[model samples]
Target chain A: MTLSSISSLTLRKTPRISDAEFADLRGFIYDVTGIDIPERRQYLLENRLGARLAELNLKSFAEYSSYLRRSPSKDKELVYLCEKITTNETSFFRDSKQLDVFRDFVLKDVLESLQQDGRKELNIWSAGCSSGEEPYTLGIMLHEMLRMSIIGWRIRISANDISTAMLNKAKDGVYNQYSFKTTPQEMIEKYFTKEPGGFKIHPKVQRLVSFAALNLNDRMALKRVPKSQIIFCRNVIIYFDEEMKKKVINAFYDNLLPGGYLILGHSESIHKFSRVFKPIIKPGGMFYRKEG
Target chain B: MVLAKDIKGADGGVFLAAGTALDDAAIASIAALGAPFAYIKPNPAFTSPEKDLQRIESFVRYYFQYVDPDSPLFNELFRLVMERVFEASQKGWAIPCEYERQAKSVEHLHDLFFRDQGASLDLVKHETSLSSFPDTYFKIKELLDSPASTAADMAKVVSADVSLAAKLLRLVNSPFFGVAGRVDSISHAIALVGVSELATLALGISAIKFFKDIPPELMDMETFWKHSLRCAVFGKCVASLLPGLTSERFFTAGLLHDAGRLVMFKNLPYASVQAMLYARSSGAPLLEAEREILGFDHTEVAGLLLEEWNFPAELRSIIAYHHDPLLSPAPRDAAVIQLADILACGVEISSTGMYSLPGMTQEAWNLLGLKTYDIDKLIRLHDKYFQELTSVFF
Candidate 1:
């Protein structure tokens, strides 16, 4: 019941990666993505990659390495691997741990609902997706999940930021290693081309998003924004007072398709702002869904 | 009372079925059958195997009781450890065969171990068998102490025991030692493994030979060695995996990590039983329970014994802090043993006297700089190596 014992519970029986496994993963990650995972952060690599192995049904990191190299969907899996190790670490994959919940729980259900409908169209609104990180991350993740099959579907991410300066940066799509601290070594290599100024985002990820300056306080503009099944208005909402929080939350709830999801910052909770949305909790954080 | 499970007799015939009610005749026959205990239904107080499992879940929960499980890092870690413990418990690794809580009270335990103050380990010097390590250990100790002694002199002492010499040669040449070229002689093995390191390992192997007198009722000696040898193998593997570590010292440290428990089990059977019971019922860790009762736990006891046996100061300190590795003078060395011991318990490789898994320090995990996947690989490796080494060792 004491504090120390409680913390120790989770740390107990953590699986370990061997020196060789660390070296192999580091080398493999470097070979593919050009980002160098240092030796000290070896624990981080294992923790992130361990989840992938469970999903892939592989036994060891070495096997995960092999899967990345030669699996039939190796290219697709590599994109995911890049997302996994780098996304959370990078501005490109901003709040993508929440994306895990989106991918596994929310998005699949949404895709299924779309499949059942006569038309194949998916809409995502990245409200306040500053410098285009959230939208670009979602684009990259979607790119892998659909296996480059975005041609058949009307997929669009309506990315809006209130600042023109930030919007221009998002459109420019140039980033540095500082923006990519959360990105895996391989992801930086795969999704970006290094330039004299900084790393350049691939046109493929950039093409999925269209950024425009839209203020949340402007009801006319909020109404004009596209209807979507998913909305990511993360840290931006925290700055608003309670009145604004409720109003903006209600706006998002109305803006979505019934049962649409709103992914938030890891620390933000929707319950205090509005009780309309049902929260779906997962590790690292929770996101909300508009209830029927 | 109705029987909740089948009561099989010595001949493997079912003497009573699940629904059988105990009358005078049935009670007489059950008493004559010499069954240790039986399940009685609708008695909420009686702990079923299922209840034992629940206790393990709660004990493990208490063991991990420090962190808010709401955080992502701990949430993931706690979930994985629970999964492992549950699997191990289901497979008969973590849970002991069901028994009623012991009747001995804390006051009774106080009377038995009260004389043995925690700080004064010299209290155990009177224990003749435990106090006296094997002659082979003392022989190497003599050489290790004497500056006049050469590596050949140490090798000659080990060679004097033909059985010890053969096991040493085979072990060095085996993949266990990772020695290059064939080591056919004790002198050559000593030169490769280091004289003191070889002596430490021999002392460990010989210490196992020394401590066979523990009663089955007090502790199962086989299970004790299984845990010890598992720690030994695991510790050796972990040491070699990390940089700038000598693997032999780790193996020896693992073997003797819980030496104090053996001493306690042998010398204070009543008090040790009480400590185990208190640890179980109160949900406190065994070391804490021991400190509460005897003022010190087995690690302290092991430290004293190792010091008396002239174990290297580093090795003595490593054993002393196996449970809390970060406190050790050489934290990494102690962390090596702690990691191995924690692994041994988590997999239910073998249960030490505590019969419950010990909680580990995050500092120890961090000190090793190993990833969780590495631990998974190590446990698999432990399984492969455990069976092979037990045969050579026991």
Candidate 2:
């Protein structure tokens, strides 16, 4: 397979498609990573992956797909595909209603009881922390609350994403004022420092969060984070097929501590997954909790 | 480095950390640092809103006293106040103290506008020509608008400017026109050029000559002309789609919309550059960012220029609010100008054209009644027109 072959694949038809080529490509993606892409998405597949073909100087989709199959260097191709197709259109404190629910009901009740016990430490994970805004937002809220109350709480926020590129950016802890759009001006002036090129979270806020790359499909890799007090795996599982979603939710249930909170995106629910977790409806948000 | 500490609060409103107060005299020493926002935020000693205003005033006074004495910062600040005070002045409210400082700065800027003749001439030369052609433009517009006006009458109006008359002849004779014979006189040229093309060409020639004195920067001779010509070409292209909008008027509006930016560049170079840089870095659309960075945008500045120079009210309105077409009570001219500017900006020009403006507000788009596809098609049309014009102009 050559670069010219892939170039022809992009414009092979107007609003272009060749069903056989698309099927082979879909199967290739599924086989390479066990992620099934629907066949009707020929336009979606072609438009997104076509740019990669050009950049890699590959001529045809055939060669590109085969490159994923034949090369032992599949990691590079997998990373490229994930980064290209993933809709990382996340914003700070996205789905505000969900966060409010978590803050008021779940955190207030669960963590307050835990605080009375010996376990005062809180571990929260924002899985798929696209470009760092979500987890950083979580960190900011937690850091400010803990500092004001003098809680002496040991808080660790771990952010994980499948895209290494996005994880690196998350670790940078710099965002323009836009991401903090909903945040009040006084908060921005106080919590964030004007860094050399952009704004930075102060070291106190920075010390609380960590970023790592992880794939949700790997159940074994998911277990390494231990029992989390709250896991915000929002806006992630909706992309997966039913079986994948069930498997990921089961893994999340197993990973959370007893009475721990599992936050899904406003639209997502775990009802179909299993009987192990019960959905809790707070005033303004919803989350799944381990049923004891 | 200034320190930023979190004010411990449940609601996430932060303030300066305890024991982290900034010395006012010390800040007064280094207020002119490259980034002043840092120094301003973390100094709890400068806590109150009034104190912040005082700090800004001291910063400005010392910024002038110690730093660049003739800096345009004062003028820029003053212009901001005038715009605010103007609205307040209308309501019979006494100007705020901050506004008084701004008023004084504006007065200084006004003095500078005249005292700096070199700058003023650069500005004047870039507007309508000091020559007789401006008078000719009004006469020609009147002739074109009148139902009974003839090409001979149009030719008589333009013939008053010998240079314009000659250019009209040259245009009519150009191979692009496909005329078998040469145009001999103004009447022949106007007849051949057609009323629409004649008006477009006359405006173009007048604008080209007006910009002769100003030296170039991001907007040089080539850039200004290219942008103007592109707008003219795009205006014609887009106006072709709408009913009742004459293509020539669209072209005229396109060429004229950014004429205010040119005026500012000539008279207020520092303010203009700062505005341009802020827009580029922040990805705010040029006009909105200009309003923030310089207190007034090119559209407003151009409106003033057009009014002071006695341009038609329609043209002035078109220039003043091209970015916000819905603001215009009259949609035809404003819509034409708005669409033209968008098409011109969206089409990729040489040197990587302006960054994408943040999308227009939904209300504004709904008011214009244009969908995404209309904008896309308009951009594509302008891209085609720009290619055609580039080959001819370059």
Cα-based lDDT for every prediction: 0.69, 0.59
Fraction of native contacts under 8 Å reproduced by each candidate: 0.10, 0.00
> How much is the lDDT of residue B206 in candidate 2?
58
Candidate 2 chain A worst ten-residue window by lDDT: A1-10
- Can you write out model 1's per-residue Cα lDDT over A56-117, one digit (the tens) per residue? 88888778778888899886776566545432212665444556667888888898888788
Question: Model 2: runs farther than 4 Å from truth?
Answer: A1-18, A28-36, A148-151, A273-275, B1-394
Candidate 1, residues B147-183, lDDT tens digits: the string is: 9999888888999989888877777887766779999
DockQ of every predicted complex: 0.04, 0.01
- Candidate 2 local lDDT, A68-109, one digit each (tens): 877787787787787654456555765555576678888777
Q: Give the TM-score of candidate 2.
A: 0.42
